[model samples]
Target: MSASTPHRPVRADAERNVARILEAAKVVLAEDPTASLERIADEAGLARATVHRRFASRKALLEALVAQLNEQYLRALHEAKVDSAPPLIALHRVTELVMEIKFSHRLVMDVVTAGTPARWSYLSAEVRERAELLFARLHASGAITAAHPSWCLKIYLAILDEVHHLPAGAPELASCADEVTARTTLQVTTVLGALGGAPLPH
Candidate 1:
Protein backbone atom coordinates (compact mmCIF):
# COMPACT_ATOMS: atom_id res chain seq x y z
CA MET A 1 0.00 0.00 0.00
CA SER A 2 1.27 3.45 -0.94
CA ALA A 3 0.57 6.73 0.82
CA SER A 4 -1.17 7.99 -2.33
CA THR A 5 -3.44 4.97 -2.42
CA PRO A 6 -6.09 4.43 0.23
CA HIS A 7 -6.02 0.83 -1.06
CA ARG A 8 -9.24 1.95 -2.83
CA PRO A 9 -11.45 4.97 -3.21
CA VAL A 10 -14.00 5.04 -0.44
CA ARG A 11 -17.37 3.84 -1.65
CA ALA A 12 -20.04 6.49 -2.03
CA ASP A 13 -22.22 4.91 0.61
CA ALA A 14 -19.33 4.74 3.04
CA GLU A 15 -18.41 8.33 2.32
CA ARG A 16 -21.97 9.41 3.00
CA ASN A 17 -22.05 7.30 6.13
CA VAL A 18 -18.88 8.87 7.46
CA ALA A 19 -20.08 12.37 6.70
CA ARG A 20 -23.40 11.70 8.36
CA ILE A 21 -21.70 10.27 11.42
CA LEU A 22 -19.48 13.30 11.76
CA GLU A 23 -22.35 15.70 11.23
CA ALA A 24 -24.58 13.92 13.71
CA ALA A 25 -21.80 13.71 16.24
CA LYS A 26 -21.12 17.40 15.88
CA VAL A 27 -24.75 18.27 16.55
CA VAL A 28 -25.31 15.94 19.48
CA LEU A 29 -21.99 16.58 21.17
CA ALA A 30 -22.41 20.31 20.95
CA GLU A 31 -25.71 20.11 22.77
CA ASP A 32 -24.69 17.50 25.31
CA PRO A 33 -21.25 16.16 26.04
CA THR A 34 -22.61 12.90 27.45
CA ALA A 35 -24.45 11.93 24.27
CA SER A 36 -23.92 8.30 23.45
CA LEU A 37 -22.38 6.83 20.31
CA GLU A 38 -25.56 4.81 19.75
CA ARG A 39 -27.52 8.06 19.76
CA ILE A 40 -25.09 9.54 17.28
CA ALA A 41 -25.42 6.50 15.01
CA ASP A 42 -29.19 6.75 15.23
CA GLU A 43 -29.06 10.42 14.29
CA ALA A 44 -26.86 9.52 11.34
CA GLY A 45 -29.34 6.82 10.34
CA LEU A 46 -26.60 4.23 10.39
CA ALA A 47 -26.03 1.03 12.34
CA ARG A 48 -23.96 1.29 15.49
CA ALA A 49 -21.46 -1.12 13.99
CA THR A 50 -21.03 1.15 11.02
CA VAL A 51 -20.26 4.10 13.25
CA HIS A 52 -17.71 2.06 15.13
CA ARG A 53 -16.14 0.93 11.89
CA ARG A 54 -15.56 4.52 10.85
CA PHE A 55 -14.46 5.88 14.21
CA ALA A 56 -13.01 2.77 15.92
CA SER A 57 -13.96 4.16 19.37
CA ARG A 58 -15.67 7.06 21.05
CA LYS A 59 -12.37 8.73 21.89
CA ALA A 60 -11.28 8.40 18.29
CA LEU A 61 -14.51 9.94 17.09
CA LEU A 62 -14.28 12.87 19.48
CA GLU A 63 -10.62 13.44 18.65
CA ALA A 64 -11.38 13.42 14.93
CA LEU A 65 -14.22 15.89 15.45
CA VAL A 66 -12.07 18.25 17.52
CA ALA A 67 -9.25 18.09 14.98
CA GLN A 68 -11.65 18.85 12.13
CA LEU A 69 -13.14 21.83 13.96
CA ASN A 70 -9.70 23.15 14.89
CA GLU A 71 -8.51 22.97 11.30
CA GLN A 72 -11.60 24.79 10.07
CA TYR A 73 -11.21 27.48 12.75
CA LEU A 74 -7.57 27.98 11.83
CA ARG A 75 -8.51 28.30 8.16
CA ALA A 76 -11.07 30.96 9.03
CA LEU A 77 -8.50 32.89 11.06
CA HIS A 78 -5.99 32.69 8.23
CA GLU A 79 -8.59 33.95 5.79
CA ALA A 80 -9.39 36.84 8.14
CA LYS A 81 -5.68 37.81 8.05
CA VAL A 82 -5.93 40.13 11.05
CA ASP A 83 -2.28 41.11 10.75
CA SER A 84 -2.91 42.77 7.42
CA ALA A 85 -5.83 44.80 8.73
CA PRO A 86 -5.86 47.67 11.25
CA PRO A 87 -5.04 46.56 14.78
CA LEU A 88 -8.40 47.27 16.44
CA ILE A 89 -10.39 45.96 13.49
CA ALA A 90 -8.15 42.92 13.39
CA LEU A 91 -8.87 42.25 17.05
CA HIS A 92 -12.59 42.58 16.51
CA ARG A 93 -12.58 40.40 13.42
CA VAL A 94 -10.44 37.69 14.96
CA THR A 95 -12.53 37.62 18.12
CA GLU A 96 -15.74 37.39 16.13
CA LEU A 97 -14.33 34.60 14.04
CA VAL A 98 -13.29 32.61 17.09
CA MET A 99 -16.65 33.07 18.82
CA GLU A 100 -18.46 31.94 15.67
CA ILE A 101 -16.41 28.77 15.58
CA LYS A 102 -16.93 28.15 19.28
CA PHE A 103 -20.68 28.55 19.00
CA SER A 104 -20.84 26.20 16.05
CA HIS A 105 -18.58 23.60 17.59
CA ARG A 106 -19.28 23.89 21.28
CA LEU A 107 -18.12 20.35 21.89
CA VAL A 108 -14.55 21.23 21.02
CA MET A 109 -14.65 24.15 23.40
CA ASP A 110 -16.09 21.95 26.12
CA VAL A 111 -13.46 19.31 25.61
CA VAL A 112 -10.65 21.81 25.80
CA THR A 113 -12.10 23.29 28.95
CA ALA A 114 -12.83 19.96 30.61
CA GLY A 115 -9.60 18.25 29.69
CA THR A 116 -6.46 18.27 31.80
CA PRO A 117 -4.10 21.14 31.35
CA ALA A 118 -1.68 18.90 29.47
CA ARG A 119 -4.27 18.23 26.79
CA TRP A 120 -4.44 21.92 25.86
CA SER A 121 -0.86 22.78 26.68
CA TYR A 122 0.12 22.13 23.08
CA LEU A 123 -2.05 25.01 21.86
CA SER A 124 -0.26 27.61 23.96
CA ALA A 125 3.02 27.11 22.19
CA GLU A 126 1.79 27.21 18.57
CA VAL A 127 -1.51 29.09 18.51
CA ARG A 128 -0.63 31.43 21.36
CA GLU A 129 2.71 32.25 19.78
CA ARG A 130 1.04 33.39 16.57
CA ALA A 131 -1.53 35.40 18.54
CA GLU A 132 1.21 37.04 20.57
CA LEU A 133 3.04 37.95 17.43
CA LEU A 134 -0.07 39.57 16.02
CA PHE A 135 -0.61 41.51 19.25
CA ALA A 136 3.02 42.55 19.44
CA ARG A 137 2.91 43.86 15.90
CA LEU A 138 -0.25 45.79 16.70
CA HIS A 139 1.25 47.19 19.87
CA ALA A 140 4.40 48.22 18.05
CA SER A 141 2.24 49.99 15.48
CA GLY A 142 0.32 51.78 18.27
CA ALA A 143 -2.89 49.89 17.65
CA ILE A 144 -3.04 48.65 21.25
CA THR A 145 -1.19 49.87 24.28
CA ALA A 146 -0.33 47.22 26.85
CA ALA A 147 2.48 47.73 29.32
CA HIS A 148 2.89 43.95 29.46
CA PRO A 149 2.93 41.62 26.44
CA SER A 150 1.01 38.98 28.43
CA TRP A 151 -2.10 41.19 28.60
CA CYS A 152 -2.94 40.26 25.04
CA LEU A 153 -3.06 36.60 25.92
CA LYS A 154 -5.08 37.33 29.04
CA ILE A 155 -7.62 39.35 27.13
CA TYR A 156 -7.90 36.82 24.34
CA LEU A 157 -8.44 33.94 26.76
CA ALA A 158 -11.03 35.90 28.74
CA ILE A 159 -13.16 36.60 25.68
CA LEU A 160 -12.86 33.05 24.46
CA ASP A 161 -13.92 31.64 27.82
CA GLU A 162 -17.00 33.85 28.01
CA VAL A 163 -18.10 32.93 24.49
CA HIS A 164 -17.40 29.23 24.81
CA HIS A 165 -19.40 28.65 27.98
CA LEU A 166 -22.38 30.84 27.26
CA PRO A 167 -25.31 30.13 29.57
CA ALA A 168 -27.96 27.70 28.33
CA GLY A 169 -31.69 28.46 27.81
CA ALA A 170 -31.09 32.16 28.05
CA PRO A 171 -32.63 33.25 24.78
CA GLU A 172 -31.77 36.78 25.74
CA LEU A 173 -28.10 35.97 25.85
CA ALA A 174 -28.27 33.61 22.92
CA SER A 175 -30.13 36.17 20.91
CA CYS A 176 -27.52 38.75 21.73
CA ALA A 177 -24.43 36.61 21.31
CA ASP A 178 -23.55 38.53 18.17
CA GLU A 179 -24.19 41.89 19.75
CA VAL A 180 -22.34 40.80 22.85
CA THR A 181 -19.42 39.77 20.72
CA ALA A 182 -19.43 43.12 18.97
CA ARG A 183 -19.68 45.03 22.22
CA THR A 184 -16.91 42.99 23.75
CA THR A 185 -14.72 43.72 20.77
CA LEU A 186 -15.37 47.42 21.09
CA GLN A 187 -14.75 47.36 24.82
CA VAL A 188 -11.38 45.69 24.33
CA THR A 189 -10.50 48.15 21.64
CA THR A 190 -11.46 51.03 23.90
CA VAL A 191 -9.20 49.72 26.63
CA LEU A 192 -6.45 49.35 24.11
CA GLY A 193 -7.14 52.83 22.84
CA ALA A 194 -6.85 54.17 26.38
CA LEU A 195 -3.45 52.57 26.42
CA GLY A 196 -2.62 55.10 23.66
CA GLY A 197 -3.38 53.02 20.60
CA ALA A 198 -5.24 54.70 17.73
CA PRO A 199 -8.34 53.05 16.30
CA LEU A 200 -8.27 51.93 12.72
CA PRO A 201 -10.55 53.75 10.29
CA HIS A 202 -13.92 52.15 9.66
Candidate 2:
Protein backbone atom coordinates (compact mmCIF):
# COMPACT_ATOMS: atom_id res chain seq x y z
CA MET A 1 0.00 0.00 0.00
CA SER A 2 1.25 3.49 -0.80
CA ALA A 3 1.68 5.38 2.45
CA SER A 4 0.86 8.57 0.62
CA THR A 5 -2.57 7.21 -0.25
CA PRO A 6 -4.41 4.92 2.11
CA HIS A 7 -7.00 2.72 0.45
CA ARG A 8 -9.26 1.99 3.41
CA PRO A 9 -10.85 4.18 6.02
CA VAL A 10 -8.58 4.40 9.04
CA ARG A 11 -10.03 3.97 12.49
CA ALA A 12 -9.58 6.76 15.03
CA ASP A 13 -7.10 4.66 16.99
CA ALA A 14 -5.13 3.85 13.89
CA GLU A 15 -5.10 7.51 12.92
CA ARG A 16 -3.70 8.44 16.31
CA ASN A 17 -1.05 5.78 16.01
CA VAL A 18 -0.12 7.00 12.59
CA ALA A 19 0.25 10.56 13.88
CA ARG A 20 2.48 9.41 16.72
CA ILE A 21 4.62 7.33 14.42
CA LEU A 22 5.12 10.18 11.95
CA GLU A 23 6.02 12.63 14.71
CA ALA A 24 8.53 10.18 16.16
CA ALA A 25 9.95 9.43 12.74
CA LYS A 26 10.59 13.12 12.18
CA VAL A 27 12.43 13.49 15.47
CA VAL A 28 14.48 10.33 15.11
CA LEU A 29 15.28 10.66 11.41
CA ALA A 30 16.14 14.29 11.87
CA GLU A 31 18.81 13.39 14.39
CA ASP A 32 20.07 10.35 12.51
CA PRO A 33 19.60 10.15 8.78
CA THR A 34 19.93 6.37 8.93
CA ALA A 35 17.54 5.88 11.85
CA SER A 36 15.58 2.64 11.64
CA LEU A 37 11.94 1.77 12.08
CA GLU A 38 12.81 0.17 15.41
CA ARG A 39 14.24 3.44 16.66
CA ILE A 40 11.22 5.34 15.45
CA ALA A 41 8.88 2.92 17.18
CA ASP A 42 10.80 3.33 20.41
CA GLU A 43 10.53 7.09 20.10
CA ALA A 44 6.79 6.80 19.53
CA GLY A 45 6.29 4.42 22.48
CA LEU A 46 4.96 1.82 20.08
CA ALA A 47 6.22 -1.63 19.25
CA ARG A 48 8.34 -2.28 16.18
CA ALA A 49 5.62 -4.45 14.70
CA THR A 50 3.05 -1.68 15.17
CA VAL A 51 5.11 0.83 13.20
CA HIS A 52 5.84 -1.84 10.60
CA ARG A 53 2.12 -2.45 10.29
CA ARG A 54 1.43 1.25 9.76
CA PHE A 55 4.33 1.82 7.33
CA ALA A 56 5.74 -1.19 5.53
CA SER A 57 9.14 0.39 5.01
CA ARG A 58 11.22 3.51 5.57
CA LYS A 59 10.51 4.80 2.08
CA ALA A 60 6.79 4.54 2.75
CA LEU A 61 7.15 6.56 5.92
CA LEU A 62 9.15 9.21 4.10
CA GLU A 63 6.48 9.39 1.43
CA ALA A 64 3.85 9.99 4.09
CA LEU A 65 5.94 12.82 5.53
CA VAL A 66 6.31 14.39 2.11
CA ALA A 67 2.57 14.20 1.66
CA GLN A 68 1.98 15.95 4.98
CA LEU A 69 4.47 18.69 4.14
CA ASN A 70 2.83 19.26 0.77
CA GLU A 71 -0.50 19.72 2.48
CA GLN A 72 0.96 22.30 4.86
CA TYR A 73 2.67 24.16 1.99
CA LEU A 74 -0.56 24.45 0.07
CA ARG A 75 -2.48 25.43 3.20
CA ALA A 76 -0.01 28.23 3.83
CA LEU A 77 -0.70 29.65 0.38
CA HIS A 78 -4.44 29.38 0.85
CA GLU A 79 -4.37 31.01 4.27
CA ALA A 80 -2.39 33.89 2.81
CA LYS A 81 -5.04 34.37 0.15
CA VAL A 82 -2.36 34.85 -2.42
CA ASP A 83 -4.76 35.50 -5.27
CA SER A 84 -7.15 37.87 -3.50
CA ALA A 85 -5.14 39.86 -0.94
CA PRO A 86 -3.31 43.02 -1.84
CA PRO A 87 -0.04 42.06 -3.52
CA LEU A 88 2.25 43.31 -0.76
CA ILE A 89 0.03 41.93 2.03
CA ALA A 90 -0.15 38.57 0.30
CA LEU A 91 3.60 38.49 -0.22
CA HIS A 92 4.33 39.24 3.45
CA ARG A 93 1.73 36.83 4.76
CA VAL A 94 2.80 34.01 2.47
CA THR A 95 6.45 34.52 3.28
CA GLU A 96 5.80 34.41 7.02
CA LEU A 97 3.61 31.33 6.81
CA VAL A 98 5.98 29.47 4.52
CA MET A 99 8.95 30.43 6.65
CA GLU A 100 7.32 29.05 9.80
CA ILE A 101 6.48 25.78 8.09
CA LYS A 102 9.97 25.44 6.65
CA PHE A 103 11.59 26.24 9.98
CA SER A 104 9.50 23.68 11.85
CA HIS A 105 10.06 20.93 9.30
CA ARG A 106 13.70 21.46 8.40
CA LEU A 107 14.76 18.23 10.07
CA VAL A 108 12.04 16.07 8.52
CA MET A 109 12.72 17.61 5.11
CA ASP A 110 16.33 16.41 5.14
CA VAL A 111 15.30 12.76 5.26
CA VAL A 112 12.41 13.25 2.81
CA THR A 113 14.89 14.44 0.18
CA ALA A 114 16.98 11.28 0.29
CA GLY A 115 14.64 9.84 -2.32
CA THR A 116 12.20 11.82 -4.43
CA PRO A 117 9.08 9.92 -5.40
CA ALA A 118 6.98 10.99 -8.38
CA ARG A 119 4.17 12.27 -6.15
CA TRP A 120 6.52 14.64 -4.34
CA SER A 121 7.92 15.91 -7.63
CA TYR A 122 4.41 16.63 -8.88
CA LEU A 123 3.30 18.31 -5.65
CA SER A 124 6.50 20.36 -5.56
CA ALA A 125 5.83 21.57 -9.09
CA GLU A 126 2.34 22.62 -8.12
CA VAL A 127 3.70 24.62 -5.19
CA ARG A 128 6.26 26.30 -7.42
CA GLU A 129 3.65 27.17 -10.02
CA ARG A 130 1.54 28.89 -7.39
CA ALA A 131 4.57 30.75 -6.13
CA GLU A 132 5.45 31.84 -9.65
CA LEU A 133 1.95 33.19 -10.20
CA LEU A 134 2.17 35.07 -6.91
CA PHE A 135 5.46 36.58 -8.03
CA ALA A 136 3.94 37.64 -11.34
CA ARG A 137 1.20 39.45 -9.45
CA LEU A 138 3.73 41.09 -7.15
CA HIS A 139 5.72 42.31 -10.12
CA ALA A 140 2.68 43.80 -11.84
CA SER A 141 1.69 45.57 -8.62
CA GLY A 142 5.18 47.02 -8.13
CA ALA A 143 5.71 45.10 -4.90
CA ILE A 144 8.89 43.67 -6.37
CA THR A 145 11.07 45.42 -8.91
CA ALA A 146 13.00 42.44 -10.26
CA ALA A 147 13.68 42.67 -13.99
CA HIS A 148 11.72 39.47 -14.57
CA PRO A 149 8.91 38.26 -12.33
CA SER A 150 10.63 34.88 -12.12
CA TRP A 151 13.63 36.52 -10.50
CA CYS A 152 11.48 37.38 -7.49
CA LEU A 153 10.56 33.74 -7.06
CA LYS A 154 14.22 32.73 -7.24
CA ILE A 155 15.28 35.35 -4.73
CA TYR A 156 12.46 34.50 -2.35
CA LEU A 157 13.41 30.82 -2.37
CA ALA A 158 17.05 31.69 -1.82
CA ILE A 159 16.10 33.81 1.20
CA LEU A 160 14.15 30.89 2.64
CA ASP A 161 17.23 28.72 2.31
CA GLU A 162 19.25 31.31 4.15
CA VAL A 163 16.66 31.44 6.93
CA HIS A 164 16.68 27.66 7.19
CA HIS A 165 20.45 27.64 7.56
CA LEU A 166 20.40 30.05 10.46
CA PRO A 167 22.14 28.80 13.64
CA ALA A 168 19.94 26.12 15.17
CA GLY A 169 19.66 27.99 18.46
CA ALA A 170 19.17 31.44 17.03
CA PRO A 171 17.17 33.67 19.37
CA GLU A 172 14.66 34.35 16.63
CA LEU A 173 13.82 30.67 16.67
CA ALA A 174 13.10 30.47 20.37
CA SER A 175 10.05 28.49 21.31
CA CYS A 176 7.60 31.37 21.42
CA ALA A 177 5.14 32.82 18.98
CA ASP A 178 6.79 36.23 19.26
CA GLU A 179 10.16 34.76 18.36
CA VAL A 180 8.69 33.14 15.26
CA THR A 181 7.04 36.41 14.34
CA ALA A 182 10.38 38.15 14.66
CA ARG A 183 12.08 35.59 12.49
CA THR A 184 9.40 35.79 9.81
CA THR A 185 9.58 39.55 9.80
CA LEU A 186 13.34 39.40 9.32
CA GLN A 187 12.89 36.92 6.47
CA VAL A 188 10.25 39.05 4.74
CA THR A 189 12.40 42.15 5.06
CA THR A 190 15.39 40.33 3.58
CA VAL A 191 13.41 39.02 0.62
CA LEU A 192 11.98 42.47 -0.10
CA GLY A 193 15.44 44.03 0.00
CA ALA A 194 16.89 41.32 -2.24
CA LEU A 195 14.10 41.74 -4.81
CA GLY A 196 14.38 45.53 -4.78
CA GLY A 197 10.98 45.95 -3.17
CA ALA A 198 9.98 48.65 -0.73
CA PRO A 199 9.71 47.73 2.93
CA LEU A 200 6.38 46.44 4.13
CA PRO A 201 4.25 49.00 5.95
CA HIS A 202 4.21 49.00 9.75
Best by TM-score: 2
Best by lDDT: 2
For 2-53, candidate 1 gives per-residue lDDT tens digits of 9757735667778778889989987877777788889899989899999989
Give the deviation of candidate 1 from the true structure as CA RMSD: 4.6
Judge candidate 2 at residue 74 and give its lDDT. Answer: 86
Per-prediction TM-score, please?
A: 0.71, 0.78
Count: clashes, candidate 1:
0
The true-versus-predicted C-alpha distance at residue 38 of model 1, in Å, is 2.1
Give the per-residue Cα lDDT of candidate 2 at 145.
83
lDDT value for model 2: 0.79
